[model samples]
Target: MLTNRNILLCVGGGIASYKAAALASKLVQAGANVQVAMTKNAQQFVGKTTFAALTRKPVYDDVFIEHDASKIAHIDLADEADLIVVAPATANLIAKLANGIADDFITTTILAATCPVVVAPAMNVNMLEHPATVRNMERLMADGVQLIAPGVGNLACGWIGKGRLPEPEELVETLSGLFQAKKLENRHVLISAGPTIERIDPVRYLTNDSSGKMGIALAEAARDAGALVTLVHGPIRGTLPSGITTIDVESGDEMLEMMLTHYDQQDLVIMAAAVADYRPTVTYDRKQKKIDGPLRIELEETTDILRTLGERKTTQVLVGFAAETENLEHHAQQKLIRKQADFIVANDVSRADIGFSSDENQVTVYGKDETVTPYAQQSKTTLAQNLIKQFAEALR
Candidate 1:
């Protein structure tokens, strides 16, 4: 996937900077046209000559050094890159980028870059956990920078925790996935997100705690993967991606109608919405006043949208989500079979730390023929990217 692609590798000032050299070599072996840029501190650990020898390209170290008299060095590199990778992203560098500091060659080039930027952080465990560093990392993610999470192991600082750089091979594979994100190009993906509202009265409604973050993440992930994505969501807490088609609905029935309307044209359908299973038999038009005594209303079952789509699926790959508090695996397996879905992504909503409205999630994917794939807890964005990649492979 990296074949002939232009990758700008930015090495930060850290012990893991040595690994950045290996990463550059591996990227070159993978057929990528790698251009290395180093911070002043990074050159202390690995000289610019080493990078130039590895990538066989002139190392870009000084922003003022314009090899071409007419073209600005940083601007030229920024404009030509297909992707920018910041390996061994030190706390200093992370803070700099997060705050828009462009004093150095690397930071300046990155500031001018419009392409996708991937950051691989490596630092002392204590520094990694520092409030300032944590805030900076979060800011980077909020700015749409892709993070290759640091590993947990013995650090060069002699402290043991989660600030080690990933192995070169793993980094290469993840980078390759970034390029292969276009695997779903020309394919149409339909994703449903958020919690459907089941109205009891004009003023009050029944809804789950879903914030639609996961579903929105999935939509963005698929869109980044080059799929024509359509997001059908109930009342969501967040804004939708600009490029994708977004349809808003208030109830499960409305969601079902929208899904059915677009089902035939979809290459893949992911039922990520927390659709209501029941609604009041009669929705009160006016706000009901305080009742004198216990009042009861009839409840009716709403349509099972996932099962309906599964049954109607012809060439489309149907996927369902099971938000269970107990028996996660069993319930996911049951849903996969009963709903006739190709895969069931199951997560425990009981965990206050991960699922529900949180940004992180841990899910187990259940497939037909008794296949189960368990994924570790991570950010919803990362999980969505991984899942979309798997689905793209399946579709291919």
Candidate 2:
């Protein structure tokens, strides 16, 4: 995917900076036209000659350098770049980038670049976990920046936690995924993810084990495929990539409202949320007393978001998720017919290894025409891309 592509690699000042060099070498070996740039502190750990030798391009650091007689160095590099990557992104440097600070050669070039930017963070455990650092990362994500999450292991600072840059080979794979053709370009997609909560009282509510991983994966995949995605989700522990329009809702009603609000503008809609089947008939203002042996409260059925969308949709391609422990195919087929979805993605959530909060998923996709295609277990990230590819083909 990197064949003859120009990559502007920005190395930050950190012990993990060596990994950045390895990444540059790998990119060069993969047939990419690699250009290396570094922060002032990075040159202290690795010499500019080391990078220039690997990429075979003059390492850029000083913005005022007279190497280019006709063009400005940073602007020229920015214009030539197909992608920008920052490895070993220290908390300090990430803060600078998140806030659009252009004090050094790397930051200045990044600011000038309009291409996609990937940030790989590496620092001490404490620093990585700091509120300030988390906020900065969130800000960058909100601005559509993609992130390669740091791995967890022993740190150079004697702290044990997540602060390691991913391996060079992994970085290369991620870049390849990003550079794939934007097949869903100019398409607008609406997705609902996570488990909605049903409140019985102000202090108590019923929820599920959904971590919103699959839905998040779909959102990222759609975003990468060049679709304008709007994500309506329940509470989540992690953050999605920067560009998605995200909305937080606690109850199934709220989710339905948000999805309907954007329904007309979407070319595709995926109802991935595990909404409550029933809600309390009468919500109490305060916690209920525990005096009685058994609490008898009436339950009411919630709105069927999938069925409603199918009934009201015009040209939108509707997809629904069916999480079942038994009779997966039967349930999936039933949903495909009853909900009028174009495709129903059914999964065996009974398996402990894949589904629910797991990072991986195994599913059998049922179509409107009674086709049942099973997908083997794989990371949610890869599964999402494959699903999108299939869906894109199905659309045609």
lDDT of each: 0.89, 0.87
| Candidate 1 structure quality by residue, lDDT tens digits, 159-187 | 87678888888788778877774878989
Per-residue accuracy of model 2 over 1-396 as CA lDDT, tens digit each: 899999999999999889899999999999999998888899888989999999888998888884879989999989999999999798988999999999888889988999989898999978888999999998898787877767656888888766878778767877887888888887998999999999999998878888898898899989899999999999777666567899999999999999999999889899988998899989999988787587787899999999999999899989999999999988999999999999999998988767597656889898897677888766576678778877776665
Top candidate (TM-score) = 2
TM-score of 1: 0.73
Query: Could you estimate the TM-score for every candidate?
Result: 0.73, 0.78
Q: For each candidate, C-alpha RMSD in Å? A: 5.1, 4.2
Output the worst ten-in-a-row residue range by lDDT, candidate 1. 235-244
Query: Looking at candidate 2, what is the lDDT of residue 28?
Result: 94
